[model samples]
Target: MGEPLTIHLPDPESAIHLAGPGEENLKLLSKQTGASLVLRGQDLLVSGPEGAVNLCRRLIEALAYLWGQGRSVTSVDILTARHALDTNRTEEFQALQQDVLARTRKGEVIRAKTFRQRQYVQAVRNHDLTFCIGPAGTGKTFLAAVLAVQALQANQYERLILTRPAVEAGERLGFLPGDLQQKVDPYLRPLYDALHELMDPEKIPALMERGVIEVAPLAYMRGRTLSNAFIILDEAQNTTPPQMKMVLTRLGFKSRMVVTGDVTQTDLPEHQASGLSVAQKILHGVEGIAFCQLGRADVVRHPLVQRIVTAYEGHE
Candidate 1:
């Protein structure tokens, strides 16, 4: 171990925030940087190799920056700080810490956890149309829905539309048991789940009734111009070429569209080509549209899910 180093944090309030609840932040910082840290009053005693000590101090400073901004520092912040420290790129880390995508009912934040995710969110914010392609566990649909809800809540858009290709329906909408709405509701459950993450589940029905929020099967989108709306097309890989063309054309004036899908997970028959795959080729240089491809590193689910995606990707 290197010689002991003492760093005193000036403010008690910031010390609390930097340390996190039950010193979880300190523990994470120590573990992540390979430095042994112990808090004594407002002073932190760090003992490790010189390199490890420097890393710990940098992480502590990063946490202080976030805490000063009233942002909750968690284990995830440690990861971001370490990445920033390693790459010597602190700007993205600072932005990621401050990017408040959405807050859940219990006040948990839902910001981008990775650097690429921050870029993805920025793409969604700046582009009129964006294509997010990634595997499971990436925040493609969820982040798009969060932005859609925030835009609707801020009155940036008059409506929030969520739709997906119900490939399983297979032109049998009438034959599917319940009324038009009920039959398609099952297919759009992912959108419902996303909405519930941003707002109260009870409030969604009233919004849907008022036409402010529309979650429906992709079939209902035909021949309808969606104006002044934030629309998300999930499961685009399941859409046929005609279906993708129809939906893309439905984006009317003052509307933004986000198409999200994992091309590798296409459910279409072996003979059928996924519209998402085809659209990427046709619209490669299209103006006003952006495509963001996220790899296994972008998977924000459980750590094991990231490994699973990476393993599968390696095989491919």
Candidate 2:
């Protein structure tokens, strides 16, 4: 333990702006530094161990610099600052950061360009199971898939399984297809696209054949237990409570699972309840599990996509 320390900002104007625009980043800093921060007019009061307080001060200063430049502070910026503080503290911290960063930046790794994506990665690393809830185009599925792939490549997991409910999104799968794979291929194309981006297209087939990677409909996972695997259940909002329970209970030793969905995009008809919505309530406060609620601001697609999502949300 160390002594408490406080920092005073330049003035109230800057303080107001930091508390407004930089509030989220500041909260993240508080978590990272294990400090309690309270703003009193122009002064930022931080109470914690001396080292942690000093690190928090440096983080606030860095944020002030960005805010002064008209740049918005992000979660990634806070994480980077935390990494810097750790590196400055000890060589062991630098080594750990290098190892984590290396794994995070693999050959086909999709860099997190938004705050939500960065938080998603952090949540996955910190928790055994994570639920990423958001609207479409928020990179929920893609990022989860990439993390699964990285786990597979690094030998962290023996296999990767990508599963999703085969609920028809206004299209009749039975009317349009050759066989089951061809029928569900449309639903799973997004998963395939993610794989193609992260791995050689030609090699993917061989990997699939070897069972190192498996992408299948949620129905196929009913009875089996999954162990030593990285499992992703996308479009989970379409799953029924029974289905969600079944899927979750299937986790065996050394397995990690990520369930992602958009509550607004549920395709289970108007009468049925969304499993994701239910799971959020049921799983709250459960240890070793994480939940991330992403908003329209987290969308990393075309700039207009974010606006469109915001527009729809505003109308609702």
Q: Name the best candidate (by TM-score).
A: 1
Q: Candidate 1, residues 1-316: lDDT per residue as tens digits?
A: 7787898877677677778889988887888988998988888899999889988887888767666655567665677678888898888787777778879888887899778788889999999999999999888999999899999999999999999988877757888898888989888888888888779888988999999999988888998999999999999999999899999999999999999999999888999999999999999889989999987767776557878988888899
Candidate 2 lDDT by residue in tens digits, 1-316:
5666656767666666566554765576788888878877777778878878887877676555544544344554455555555556334322322333222223422455444567788899777799999998888988888788888989999999999988874445568659977888888898998887777789888888999989888888988999999999999999989899999999989999999999998889899898999999999899998999888767766546878999999998
Q: What is the C-alpha lDDT of each candidate?
A: 0.87, 0.77
How well does candidate 2 score on lDDT at residue 310?
90
Candidate 1: regions farther than 4 A off: 6-32, 36-45, 67-76, 168-176
- Which pairs in model 1 have colliding backbones? none
Could you tell me the lDDT of residue 86 within candidate 2? 55
**TM-scores, in order shown?**
0.85, 0.67
Model 1: per-residue Cα lDDT at residue 108: 81
Q: What is the overall TM-score of model 2 with all chains considered together?
A: 0.67
